[model samples]
Target chain A: MNELHIPTMAQMAAEGKAPEILFWVGCAGSFDERAQKITRSICKILQHVGLSYAVLGTEESCTGDPAKRAGNEFLFQMQALTNIEVLNAYAVKKIVTGCPHCFNTLKNEYPQLGGNYEVIHHTELIQQLIDEGKLKTEDNESFKGKRITYHDACYLGRGNNVYEAPRNALQVLDAELVEMKRCRSNGLCCGAGGAQMFKEAEPGKKEINIERIEDAIEAKAQIVASACPFCMTMLRDGVKIKEKEQEIQVLDIAEITARANGL
Target chain B: MIAQLVFLIILAAAVFLFSKNTGKIRRNILLGKDADRSDQPALRWKTMAKVALGQSKMGKRPVAAIMHLFIYVGFVIINIEVLEITIDGLFGSHRVFSRPLGSLYGLLIGGFEILALLVLVSCVVFLSRRNLLKLKRFQGPEMKEWPRSDANYILFIEILLMTAFLTMNAADYKLQALHFGHYIKAGSFPVSALIAPLLPSNASSLVMIERGCWWFHIIGILAFLNYLPYSKHFHILLAFPNTYYSKLSPKGQFSNMASVTNEVKAMVDPSFVPAATEPGRFGAKDATDLTWKNLMDAYTCTECGRCTSVCPANNTGKLLSPRKIMMDTRDRITEIGNNLDKQGKDFQDNKTLLDDYISREELWACTTCNACTEACPVNIDPLNIITEMRRFIVMEESQAPPSLNNMFSNVENNGAPWKYSNADRMNWAESD
Candidate 1:
């Protein structure tokens, strides 16, 4: 296993087109079409508001979290070093990844491999873009009377503390935002963390996602919004399994942002 | 003056009983040998500072950590009160303040008694949290053979202590009424004021009650001191240092493997034959397999069940209870020590007890997720023992779960746990 050594946000921001931000479409976001579409929509909004940005598709890599949690520390280190080297080569900085796992690993775990970077999750960047008047919600009235709920992804909310950005982004659209009983630091794990997303849980009493989606239903939310691509996928799956897909919608925070933008 | 002599006698008796019981506990409960000279002192002192003073292990949860800090400080402060009580019992006069800065001393003593009460109440809350409220992670793992005696002993000791405390105050209050003809100035403890109304109006009755309660209190202390080594209260003394001396390594860091190359090299040489001596065991197979510090963790378990409650493996209906792992190790150590202490060289006959103490199935069920290690307020590293057991099984017996063996072989052969070809590994990198 080779190391993934990537550049920091400060370094990347200094080089290339010196784009206002580098949107890092992680492995999950690249593979998942819905997430890809939402990211594209967010990018379209960023471009529309004249915010200079470069999408660093090549700078992306598995955050090596799955490997580390699996006790393959050497593999994770190799992946981290390799990612660092690629990012360094591209002179990429000010990273914005849609995946909380990638964002958390790049910001928190990479320092152990000697890669320090100012990595922001996509919601923070999108909300920042909106706050700066670079993105707008033209159809804010669409969610005027509709009640929505925000599901705090463990990695994004508790693992890193990106709670405010996603909620703020949704609230900016004037939607009725309700919080599930367990939100923020005490937010329940979506059972998708620690690369449990890739592996099947060994026949537990309940699927972790069902527990979380049930909480959303308890909140009486018409839609359950999440920031991480994995959370979106799990919640969507939970909605299907619980036979509530017709009554409830699972959406990525970016999709909500896109809808608000009338894109 | 007679009372002063009695107090001195009680103090001496307490010291004797406490020292005796603690010695027994060190020998039996933890099988704690006088630490080896090779033991790290600098590490121990550093650990004491961080764990005893800093509450480092309790840092995972703030409420629990802060509560522990109060208890620790309260324990230290109340020691002065214990000495004061001993002196008062020996002296004709209850002159704990009969020294320099006596008023200030009394105030400090009073403050600490109140704090001690608070700490005691909080401990009760913590206990309730484990047994009743069912805080998600505080319930200890269910043991196949929990020392049923230990639970009974713990309940008995706590009740005895609380009773002794209340009785001691009652004695003091009655004696004060007898001497002063009304009420003695209630010391710093506000609860002691309750003694004023409860005192018998008849002087002789009050005196008899005081004498009886005084003796009962002293005897309770002695019995508790003697019982310390045999019961779970052993942690009451050991928790401070054990929590501090915890492993500095990350939760994932296992006991380092023995230098394998040296042995393998000699084994491969045509003229060489390996010695029949035990192969360098990577993990613990029995009590002797544990390091002294690992043994220390056994003595330090309060049996509060905090580790078992939070364990993902246990909650998922697995056999791996982190609490029981420590208890099993502790019990096995005690059993081995008791055997060795009584039978000396003939202790090898008792090896059968080891197999029954911990099952290989329970040992293998741990996911090493660190939730147990994380939730332990005392910072007992239960995962280390699990990993150690795994290491021994894999290295010594060449035994492993079938899938794990396949995974290990795949990694050695293909540089990945999966059997996928290297071409697939490069696909993620090569793809646009």
Candidate 2:
């Protein structure tokens, strides 16, 4: 682990300085053990590019995506309004999130309730940094010619039509990008969306993630790349189910970018 | 003269029955809660044109699309000939248009014959696809008895009606050849010409066959018209109106709850005290709670299984069938309407759409992916209905799954979906 000193938005505001973007560390990034690595990877990429960023830290709350999706509209509104009040108090204008669910809620759903901000998914932010020549990647032989297939998170792909950003980020790694039969607009879900991640799956012939992983295997990719934390969890579980964990690795786009940059 | 009197009596009875059924369907659909989608008249018209008239989304499955187009176009065009039939049956006239229109009537009848053949062929293929080939989408638990039998019954009716039409034309051609009483030599029947050879050449028998077939054709058309309100075949009439009022907003944008949003606004504004109002039940627990557009969508469902075929959950062997959701909604509304008609509107059935029709497992299996909505040619949003019912379960009954219960409690105490407090949010950013 590397020591990383990250300042809070409150600290930045008190110092009469404002970070360019607020990193919304969603619940998965903040508390889930595996998703925490993805959060650190995103932080490393931001630091590597010399981007000014600050976290909401203790002041941040959930964007109420799960509650909304789970049908508790009242709870969702309460959660959304509390977060909106804190963000509005700090005059936060731009936000970047590692989770597509949070990104989607903040970008699409928050506007109606007066919580408007320029929300960008981490993969999209990374793609922007690469395009701007701020983030550089060497021809790393570690991932060179490695067959990788990018799984489109529903919220990032069909939910928002963000099909290009994550793929563009992976293009920088010099990996052979193989596409699953159901990719982009036709992508299948990882079975974790719409609050399914919080509940046991209903009885079915096969889990949705398993079916999705079969698509990855059919694509013959050794690495499955995902842009959303929920997708990463589902894909990883699928790989474990097939007992191919040793052969196949499920990783976030940020983790790949961080690894390639040797940050 | 007495024969014509009997025909008028039969026609009146059929019309009365058809109108009564139509009225009941209209009342049942209006039982749903109101949702104001009346804005954007130009957009609504364009949507109706593109979706219902143009059949734009049908192109997703090209083979089925073409087959459906043949049936759809044939159904619309052939009904014009029915208008003439209605006039003739009511006035006791024979070939009324042929006398004035002459050769144009020949061309028109010829065109109708061709369309009738096409509709016959399309219906046969559709029937084989449903019954013989047994497409997976058509055989699911949701399509159990009534749906499956209802589909075959409509196809059977169409086959009978088309047969009766061609038979009537063939028998009339024979009678005209014999120069029988009141049988004028007019209106070409190209397709039916082949069938004329199969019939007996006797004048008396030909007259009986022609009269019988004519009566059957007209009466069957009236029966089918009335049956439309009771069957999923109602899409023949409701598709236009349903598509006309389709949601113009982007699919991903969920509508905000005005009640909850106002409360949130009050929380932020210091001087704004929220009105002390009783909290109403959230989301839809039954068909009545749904919007009128949702009810229209139910009636507009063609039972085409396109939504179910493309549903990722159903494809992955999950129980969430979007087609079933719409069918269930329609069935529930009909039941409620019947209850209201039999007993007063105040009658309670002690049953609800939530448990009696749709199961919690089916509702929870949905991923809210919008694939069903995208695949629907009529723009029915099953995801919207699913979300509404889920809202009822969680908000009104507090019956969310245990895992969701954990997440809810965590959100309440920690302001997030995890058990950890916000104090630990920055821990992930800390270095070892």
Candidate 3:
């Protein structure tokens, strides 16, 4: 019953000024205050760069991804059509989102629903913000010596092959980056995403996220960073459960980008 | 000679009765599952050929495969030997054709007997590896359901076969000594030499014992043959076809949702609104719901346990066991086949054989990883069956993991499964 929604690239292109850019705010971004804040920061940056764009809010429905994956094809279709109706009404095109799950669902799965859109993750956009010299890092010399390890969300890296964007954004900041043995394509799931982030995992001897977190801790990192809200939440919870919350902080890629932009 | 004739009659009668009872056994297992004839002649023949003859994917262990091959070939070739032995018992003849040691007729019998002995030794190794030593790994639900009854039958046949060979050799040694006078040149055979001192000095009595051993050997074979269609030995006929027509393509390809028709409507239309179909029926619940090839896979498993060993879910101590699923499906299929005449009589409502076969916990434990399918030697895809069951659990019963309920509700209410307020969707972009 996980209702997913997707906005079509074709319909979005035909309407509403073809918004110089589209903001693909995912389910978590719609709900989580911090995630929403990061998304708004990126939109503000686009505006500052003289790029006009439209944010669709919750009119963007579920991506029909979780239902299809859970083998509930019927529910997936309902969510897909509902979102398609919304996009057609607004005449919206193009999208940018902070949530990797929404990004993947829109870029990869929506085409199956006849809603093909050119979707870009926010980190890819943030690097553009830095390369154009439109934004500069804040003097948070506090972050200078901190050893941060980037946890690759499976969807962004393995699922869709968006590996370097997050890392490249992290490089623009001065934090030292550590690497886990299981990184990139071989990265472990944070027991979230694929609707897994919402449901309790099939009962097993170990929590998948804890297992993933232990790998990050083994790298001796002072911070764990990610691009997806689900990974951020799961890893943050994992750090607390492992009693490493204060010792190792979890931050979104956008949070890092915003801080580097001196916001 | 008259005693031998009576023995032959009794052995033949026992075989007939055993074969007759197969239908009953087949029916009892089919309860709770749909039993119907799939109308694909080409598929049936292809499955039969691949599973029965090829056994190409039995396992990775070549030694075990070679040993099993010897037993398989011996079981087939020894049937001819059994017929020759049955005739000799009924007619008071020692040899099928009267001829000297160098003659083709004499040589033919000698070669068959040698091969039979070789197969017997190989079966001993197979038994030791499987049961006594407790070697070989297996996963999935069906592993636990292996009926010990079949093991007993296999052991009894092996014993009878070895005993008959030894006793017949002892009697032959006595006959050679009494008829050919010392027969030192004929003593080259090792088994005959060991039994020569044990055989009675009377030449006619030696021939009588030899005829008795022949009856024992032939009856043993008949008993085992009648067991074929009913027992796990069903794999002896099923594995070859499962291998030959196995999914030659990769497991990653989703069955094309775009091209599939209504009859093949495996997925919901991505373009339409969602509606309820049936309860407890999102995927396949039982055998009939499976594709034609999947049915073939159920019959073809050799119970070798190779697929079970490599399963990550099983190794990690989850309840999903792939071996048990195959065994249970075959067991269920045979039961349904036996009861085909009953016509839609609710088998599950009976609360009979199926209760002990497959469990609900075992069914839900699968992650649909395709690991078991990849590991199977004969290409039996256990994940296919597991996924089919998942469909039924969700679509028909409207039952799934409790967490999925929360997810379904979130997706229904919000555009996604997350529970945040709609107003905050773009808070990130506006934040300092």
Candidate 4:
């Protein structure tokens, strides 16, 4: 077993040391059993690349994405202001988020609340790591020739114009990358946006996640690659509901890159 | 002299009525909440050019774009002849520019004839799309009897207008060749020349067909101008202004609630006191609660259903049709505007854009995926209005779905949407 160290921002601050990047392990990444794997994968990649990064740990809170999207602006600003105070106290300058929701909120919505930071989605960081040539899975053939289709997370894709980074991260692997019928700017939501993750879809014939997963099935993708935590949850449930659990697998980009690189 | 006087009265009445209706539309649109879309003039201009004038977004569907261009370009260019027609009508003259421009007049009329033919063919194709073939985008819950008939009615009017223009030119061409009185050879007729052989050879009969079509064509144009305020075809004019004022931010970034921010600041900081502002409505319940841009978006909707067709919720049998949202908004405002006209400006109607027209179920069905916004060729944003209504539901009415209420409470209490304690946030790191 490999031993690894994860530092909290408080620990770094107490040690009078500053990490280069703050890894925003969003609420789903922290609590969801499946998303925890993605959180670890991102940490492993940061460690392997010898980049200095720290987590906010207990001091961190939800970025108020679900609250905001659910139209509880009061609750949203409350959570946002709390998180901003924490981030500003640490004088955090840069961040990489494991989820698109956190990435979008920290990057776009935070500035108006005075929580300005250079934020990137984990897939974007992975793309950059690949470009810098510090991260490699050149010899890893686990995903070679597998029909891997990438799901564009709404927050990462049309929301922030990040259609390329996730695909580019997948490109470094030796896999057959296919596209669902709706991809990029035309990508379908996984029924989790606007706080739908916590609610039953309003009287619809079929769930949105089921509809999105069918697109993956139609594309003949064995492994559906995703970048956002909420997307991963919805897609995993979708595959389970379709009884395609045996035939199809849902994995986040970080998990894929981490596994392929033996991290 | 009597004919000219009648024409002058008809033109004045059409212009006056059109202005009055459009002025009411402007007032209704202005009744919406203010929004700041005027900061970036250059960017807005470029967007208007690309989305409206250039029709860049329409390029997604090549067949529709090409056909639409025929009508759009032909309509703009052929209207040059409307000016000539007006001058001729007022002065009681035939081919008013013929003697002054000479050969240029012939070239212009030839081009107008060619354009009129294309517009005719295009309207036929557009009509077929609605009635014959029945493209799925054109049919939906919002597309009721009137809207369906209204679409065909516009196309039929266009066809009739083009037919009159060409047939009138055809009869005039025959009279010119026969050297009839005041029908001197002037402009060329490339398309109408072909129809000339089909006309009756009798000079008096030719004069009647020519004169009748002349009156019909001009009157039809005027009627169509007045109809612009009532029909979805008003997009031809509103699309320009709508695109210019569209939300330019990234689709994911919803506008932060400045009002909420002030209240939150007062709560967080003991020293800070919020300004004594009028208690802002949480979100939009009525059309007037929405921003002017959102109201204009309602008017600018072409009823194309591109947004609804691409909507994931709509695609999967959900009640959330973004096109319906826009239409309902337009209908609501128009209803309010009418009531205001009848019962004074302060009259309050119990109806609202939210539940009265758009249901709560339809509102919740939206994932805020922005598929509708992306799909709109004219840059209409159905999502902004969706979020605004959602804000009204959650913040003002406290009527978010039970599931969302639980999530909100969890977020408020535990610092996350789920019921996990903040103390355990770093548990994932314990694996190694």
Candidate 5:
């Protein structure tokens, strides 16, 4: 592991200070190996822009999205209430997360349980940063006209309708943004939602992730860009299944954006 | 006078049967738990107008939509003639409305004849589409014996009723031409006029044919009215109210469980303790536990298979079929109603909607994609029922799948879905 001095919200609070936003390190971002890279890329971008943000560190827990979606309401409530209590104690007002699931639960579901916060997905935050001219992209030809296709994560795209932010963030890279046939509201799920990531899929002709990957391939995208870690995992697995892992790269919007900015 | 008295008795019997069946259906729907969807009268009315009356969502598939609209409009407008039939049957009058309305009655009857002809054509096309064309959505496992037969039965009844109507008008026309008893020039029947010449010319035979056709037409309409309560065709009556009470919130919004929320709130708040009631089951395990809207949705389903056709899980070869969900719910409610009828209101059967009707595998197969809800013309929310059932299995029985069990434990102990302690949560932030 590379040394990265990430501040904690507790440290900031103890110092009688507050950052502009709280970076919610969702479970996947916190512990999953591949997802950790995306988390680091987001951190790199935040550091490069000098945007003040702090993690909840050990204070962060699962948003209980998986538990709730899996029908474990009691578990979901327990986890959610614990997090809500902490968030309320810190008087946290704004949250930015790399995972669409966390983004959805924190923004939409949490408010119902009195954990109201201005929650934003990392793509949206990245787009905002680019829009404000705080983050500048390198004018390099490395990915200037590369054919990139964006997969819409269900929780982000259909669940919350944040279709444009990821695209806008991708557009900042000056890459050709190709759309699969089923894009936006009509987009198919990568199949790892509603706690599907944890369980085996019921019998089917084909895995949904493979079907979605086929769409990405059909679009002839050189790079498959995603905004959610679960989508990144599913799409990468799909690319591997096609045995084109060497030819096609599956990357997060943060990774591509960080690379584009030479962060 | 004897004929008039007989007609009155038949009419009363039909009305009583129709009302009794409708009342039973209404009571079964009310057996579901109360949910206050009565807010926003204006929005509800607008939804009813757009979805039920305007058939806006049906427009997603234009061919079916146009055909459906024709039948729907015809069904509503043609029923006006029933008023004339009812009055005539009771008072032994002929051309009663024609005498009062004059030329307007001629135009009205002509318009009805044209609409009736259109309805007949639409019904035939729909029948052929279901039977001959064999649309994939219409022939799935969910549409087995009774559903298929029920569809065919409605179409057959519609054809017979329309034929009787045209034949009645044709025979009436022939009677007038032959100067039969009480037969006078009254209303126009442009479509039936072509048939008048083909009928028997004898005055007494023409009177018998006319009276026979009239009686069949009126009696068929009454029988159709009663049969609707037992058929998916009940959508013809319930669609309006079902659409009116549809969930007006954003499609993505899942209603939070209020009881669970209150309990969680009490835990979070130091000053509060949720009052103890006998700990209620967290979600629906039986038909009665579901909200009344869910039962109303079941009754209002047209079984058009639009929802099943678009369902991701069903299309992907999973066991989840939204149409089947609605049908099973309706079947369970009907079963409960029958049990109550036999055992007098306090009847308890060991059967439950969860295991007996809807299987756990079926509920688990749903992706919560909302495709079914969006595709449904009548706005049925199959996802809500699936989620509720899944909740019952998880919260009450602790019977979630093994993977879900792992996730629940992780969330409970580690505050996340992964098997890692919170102390290690920030390790990724420090990793290169």
Candidate 6:
């Protein structure tokens, strides 16, 4: 808390100071221990790049992604409309999210509910920052030759067709970017989507995340880079299951980019 | 004269049965909920052209695409010969277009003969792939005895039909060489020429053989037309419209329920009381609760199991196969349609798509990953059906899995899915 004085949208509005982008730290980013690291990494990048951004902090609620996906539309819409009213009160224009679920709900679903705003996943923003020469990654020698594979979050890749953005962001890393056999639109899920993370997996011979981890293992990737917070949780759990946590590390794309850039 | 009359009667009966079945299918599909897919005609047409007409998505598997193209192109192109056969059968005329078209008739028949041979080979390859090779996508619990046999039956029918076509051409070529009555030298038969010498050495027997083959080919085609409605092979006809009405929006966006929206609005504004309309069921519990497009998607499924093969639940040995979801939907709808035919519209069968066809366990297993939807060649959305049924389970029956109930409660009480207080949300920011 020393030098990092992150302002909430409430404080920014009260001070009559407008930020360029609203950083949507989704539920996982807000509460999950591992996902909070991704949230911090994204915040570090924004600070390093000198982007004026504000978070909702305590004002933020779950984007209702889990509720909506679980078929509780009433609860989802109630949460969504509350967030929408608060966002509209600030007249926020551009938003960026650390979770694909949040990114998808804000970008695609919120518009019809009268909460239209320019929403982007953090990977897309990071790629844009690199392309614009605002963020330099020439210092990414930490991952110079590490064989890193990216696990496509279903909400990001197939859900919204953002396959290239995350991959392009990885280009900034000097690490070797390997691909799972089922990559891009054909990428396998980590078995945590559609509220499956909140419930016990139904009876199955093998859990889906283990199957996904097996794919990553087959690719011989030393590091599996993730983009979404939910995916980070799933992939980490997968690594733990196979007891390969010491050998194969899972890091979010933002974390990788932040580390590579010396942020 | 009597021969022409008999041909007309057979053709009429085939056409009547075909139309009747097709009409019934249309009616059954329309029995579902209404949804407006008529927006963006230009884009819809383009998508249909690219996916259905061009078969662009089939290129995902190069081997299957080329093999399918052989049959698709052959099926479309060989119909020109069917046209000629129809005219000849009706008027008792031989090679009716020969004089008008001149040498082009020879060129056309030559191409048809070559295509027929390719179709024969392609069907054999397809048959072996299904039976001998047994690709995993073709095997599943949903692909029961009838589904497996339906695929085989279509291939066998295609093989026999193509053979009959070539044999008819061979016998006709031999008769033409002999200058037999009504067998003229009008068409080329490159592939069938090899079999011409093997045909009956006598002219009269060649006539009988030629006529027999002609009857078989035409009859087989008519029967196949009538069989399309009952088989997964219906994809050949329904894929066009199904692709045209594909979900144009992004996959992650589920349609917000208007009923829920009204309730929430009323809670906030108080003055925004919605009209007192008869409330529809919260989610789909029965086949009729699905949208017309969903019902059509069921009929359009080829049971290729592409969706199921890519399904995470199915891959992990879960009971939830997207292919099974679709098959069960189709089966339930067909059953309901039959019940309607017998017992009238007001009659109730007391059966439902939820418990009877698709178990709750299968619905709960889905992660809603969209792999199934992306993998479907015809764009059938099993996710939509899964979600629709989930809505019924959650809202109508309140039968959600116990873990999800806790999640819903946590989100309702706190601001997040977990039980953490909202005050702790910025703790990570402060620590960093």
Q: What DockQ, between 0 and 1, does each candidate earn?
A: 0.08, 0.60, 0.18, 0.82, 0.55, 0.86
Better by TM-score, candidate 6 or 4: 6
RMSD of 4: 1.5
What value does the interface RMSD of model 2 take?
Answer: 1.5
Model 3: runs farther than 4 Å from truth? A1-69, A76-198, A201-263, B1-54, B86-94, B97-114, B130-132, B136-146, B180-205, B241-249, B253-302, B330-357, B409-432
Clash totals for all candidate models: 33, 0, 74, 0, 2, 0
Model 5's DockQ?
0.55
Q: Sort every candidate by DockQ, greatest first.
A: 6, 4, 2, 5, 3, 1
Identify the candidate with maximal DockQ.
6
lDDT of 3 by residue, B1-432 (tens): 577768768777876786576545433433333323445657656755654465454444678778877777777775665666666667755555433434654455555656666777786776676567766462233445445546546756776786687677667766766664322223223554565677777877777787678667776666666777656676665565456566543343223222212222234444544443332334565554555566566666666676566543455455657877887777666656545656564545343222355565665555443546655766687766665565456656778677776777777776566665555454444344
What value of lDDT does candidate 4 attain over all alpha carbons? 0.92
Error of 1 at B425 (Å): 12
Clashing pairs in 4: none
Tell me the whole-model lDDT of each prediction, alpha carbons only.
Answer: 0.64, 0.87, 0.63, 0.92, 0.86, 0.91
Q: Find the 10 residues in a row with the least total lDDT in model 1 chain B.
A: B423-432
Q: Comparing 3 and 4 by lDDT, which wins?
A: 4
Best model per lDDT: 4
Worst 10 residues of 4 chain A by lDDT: A1-10
The DockQ-derived docking category for candidate 4 is high
The C-alpha stretches of model 4 lying farther than 4 A from their native spots are none
Provide the RMSD of all predictions against the true structure, rounded to 1 decimal: 8.0, 3.3, 9.9, 1.5, 3.4, 1.3
Q: Which ranges in model 2 have alpha carbons more than 4 Å from their true place?
A: A1-7, A40-53, A123-146, A164-179, A256-263, B1-9, B98-106, B172-190, B262-271, B275-279, B310-319
Give the CAPRI class of candidate 1.
incorrect
Best by TM-score: 6
Candidate 4 per-residue C-alpha lDDT over A42-141 given as tens digits, one digit per residue, 9 for 90 to 100: 9888988989999999999999999888888999999999999999999999999999999999998999999999999999999999999998895577
- CAPRI-style class, candidate 2: medium
Q: How far is candidate 6 from the true structure (C-alpha RMSD, Å)?
A: 1.3
- Which scores better on DockQ, 3 or 5? 5
lDDT of 6 by residue, B211-265 (tens): 9999999989999999999999999999999999999999988998888888998
